[model samples]
Target: MSPVPNARVLFNAIPQGVPTPGQTTVYDSSQSIDLESHPLNGGFLIKTLVLSIDPGMRTRMRSTEEKSYATAFEIGQPLEGFGIGVVLRSENPDVAVGKYLQGRGFLHQQYFVLPSLPFGMFFLDRHPALPLTTYVGALGLPGKTAWAGWKDYSRAKKGETVFVPSGASAVGTMVIQLAKLDGLKIIASAGSEEKVEFLRKLGVDVAFNYKTVDTRGVLEREGPIHIYWDSVGGETFNAALDNAAVGARFMECGQMTTLNSVGSHAITIENPMAIFGKSVSIHFITSFLIIPKHLEEFNRVVPAALVAGTLLRSPEDVRHGLECVGEMIRAVQSGETRGKAVVVLGEA
Candidate 1:
């Protein structure tokens, strides 16, 4: 066997702020591997097709001392995330050659060997209705996170108003759909006009560009927000607290506004009293907590909804090639990615 290209995205530096391509992350295409001769142990080799670049991953790209739900990415090592791929060779019978699999912590490489299908890796049976990309996105962690939050944390009720900030994102879009389905009025916000338009397309009761409008004023005018499905947790989080109605529920999923501050600093709530005085309940939600409890139900219901078009796969900013992996990371951390930032590593 001869060595062929096996390039991967590497963690080049620990960012003090918003990570930059080449600075924080670097695409290294110089590496190569002998596919047939590479040690697989009892696992297999996979050819990656698509990878999901999530906002939460920014937390992982930090120093170990900083800490996060997931372990920090090591500098000068291949970075990892969720992706779907086709098995190229196998030593494990549970997974077979040519079968598609969705994996957690997949090295961001064109091709690599998996030790085994551990906790978050499994073979996926190809269904024409359920695209592989969605397996890493809307129907993936973001979808599961949205479903779990709505099911267990949203505390939503019919006719109540919910404010969904970051409303055009993967989780945001899914949450909006779920809230609308359950008869909630959605007051959603996004940074760009395009995202606001997308929220409107999802039939949000009120959608606006938070960058230009008076966010607090709008919240005070239209709300008494019954539920705040917050992913962007800097200014919007405080605004949600200020305009929150009595006994409002806050489903705290992500904080993109503070993503870059993981190692250096933290954000404080502007009005802490609103949470206490308003009798608001805050629930921190994560896919890790939810997946164990609801994986079966999520797998059963989500795929069907996505296939039936009741739950549209969240909009994606799909890019091609491993070269753009760093670019994707930059966009996701900087909050410029319009949707779920995904990288097409190869044709599935």
Candidate 2:
């Protein structure tokens, strides 16, 4: 195959007034993506198979910075995010061809090249014991996100009860398993009964269907969840706030509400007074903030957890072919799909 131009999906404009599928614009290997044939400058080609479609992308697409964590995507340019791919070609000795890698600012595309950047690093050095896709799930960002939420922000301890919202989603799944490994009693909430059952199979002490289970009441019934991992930020967050025990730690992790275009009203946690009264701390966790100093920590701890049979990677939901990228993303966005939504470009 000759090195032809590459094509990728780009965001046309931030959807401010209405939600239209047209907001995403796709292109064939020409716009904002880097195109270089040489690795002289630490550039490498990636064949993206499974592009991650996440809820946080909703907040990223908005124009507001009041509650956003990362840089907003540039209009008419290819949007960037974490995606799993194979190194098709590499100029840098550190990154070799045919190796599996995970990168940020990666998108729903087939083949693209990028310069070495923080978002462009982190290659999987052939963990023969695990499936290649595990890098995108259990051993990847979602795994790190779950680990940080539990280990750093929540400070979850053995035998303590931990509540995780969006339990069937990517990060939620990892949170459940990691918390379980830590000997914390795991309680989770998923949007559907089927999802709740899925969590139960994962060894959750309690799993509730978010739609019908009166999540706040359920949490109260469960009693004293030491750490509340809020993955679904609107009502579910409010529910967590109501159900938290005194001195409970609340970790603000994600906003699944943004995906539904929920109103931008101020959400005041009554628990703040309760939090202050009980000396509780609310911490925000972002996997991106796991600094270079902490990268070694994650690189060491997470893999060990997987190898030791502590953290488990569930079945991945893969969309075959590059052209199906948009449809795959829609499946995730519409909540019609569960687990890690990805596209496979080729073999590792």
Candidate 3:
């Protein structure tokens, strides 16, 4: 076969806060495979099928040289995140052509060559019962994050009230469904009435528009919350702290508000002493950490729940092609897209 034409999105520049179109650029090229010249004797080439657009990518765009949990994207390089793809060429004995796989490090690219499977990489089990997109969304990182937060960290029990902010998000949606399945009473907050209604339909006991409602007041009325699955870390976090029951578990997932801040503005809790009074047990959760620590449990439990229909899979907001990635990222950061924002590269 002739060389494959490839299109990719590159990290053009670091952004001050949320990434804009200027920080990323798209270019086209072509690649050919040669077994003798290949870097990995047993390597494979794959066609990108679905790329995930996550809010966590914002942290990677920071210009600072100091490294956090994730490495900062290099200027003039393809920006990487989670994705699902199909093998187009393979030399590895364990892997074969036409098989689907899931892993990180995919850009908004049409094709990629891999020497070996990276950490957390696995062959996707193509069950006709499940959609391929689910491997990148509910059956992927976001689902595992929720499972780890609820099972390993929070340990919320039956009849206990669990509060989840950003309840319509990829991670939050799973948290709500899992909490409900565990027999916990769920109080969820969303940015819009539409998302609030979406949460209600997903079986949350109480769903409210955090943009308009007085969160603290609502929590005070309906909660002595046993578990607070916090994804939005601004006023909502403080509100949850204020309303936490004694011995409550606080799972800190992400700080979206501070991440999206443009300048020197920072999020500060007015009443830091609130947690002291309640004796809240706080656990900061990074999903990457879960992969190394709890991969076994996550792989066993989450997929079962997904198959059994106990765990609700959020609808995807899929944008077509690599060119739309910047706009998709902006929409996710601005809270314009509902559920998971995914970029479908092309039909596999």
Clashes (N, CA, C under 3 Å) per candidate: 0, 12, 0
Off by over 4 Å in 1: 262-264
Task: Summarize candidate 1's per-residue lDDT along 21-133 as a digit string, tens digits.
Answer: 88998989898989888889998999989988888887787778975779999988988889888989999898889998886868899998877786787778666977578
State the RMSD for candidate 1. Answer: 1.6
lDDT of each: 0.84, 0.69, 0.80
Instruction: Find the 10 residues in a row with the least total lDDT in model 2.
Output: 31-40
| Model 3 Cα shift for residue 65 (angstroms) | 1.0
* Candidate 1 pairs with clashing backbones: none
Please report the candidate that would top lDDT against the real structure: 1
lDDT (Cα, tens digit) per residue for candidate 3, span 275-340: 778778988887776655677777777777778877778867888888888878888877778668
Q: What is the C-alpha RMSD of each candidate to the true structure, in Å?
A: 1.6, 3.6, 2.7
Q: How close is candidate 1 to the true structure, as a TM-score?
A: 0.95
lDDT of 1 at 100: 86
Cα displacement (angstroms), candidate 1, residue 225, comes to: 0.5
Expressed as tens digits, the lDDT of each residue in 266-324 for candidate 2 is 44565555555566677877677753435677788777777887666654677666555
lDDT of 1 at 269: 79
Q: How do all models score by TM-score?
A: 0.95, 0.83, 0.90
- Candidates 2 and 3 compared: the better one by lDDT is 3
The local lDDT score (0 to 100) that residue 102 gets in candidate 1 is: 81
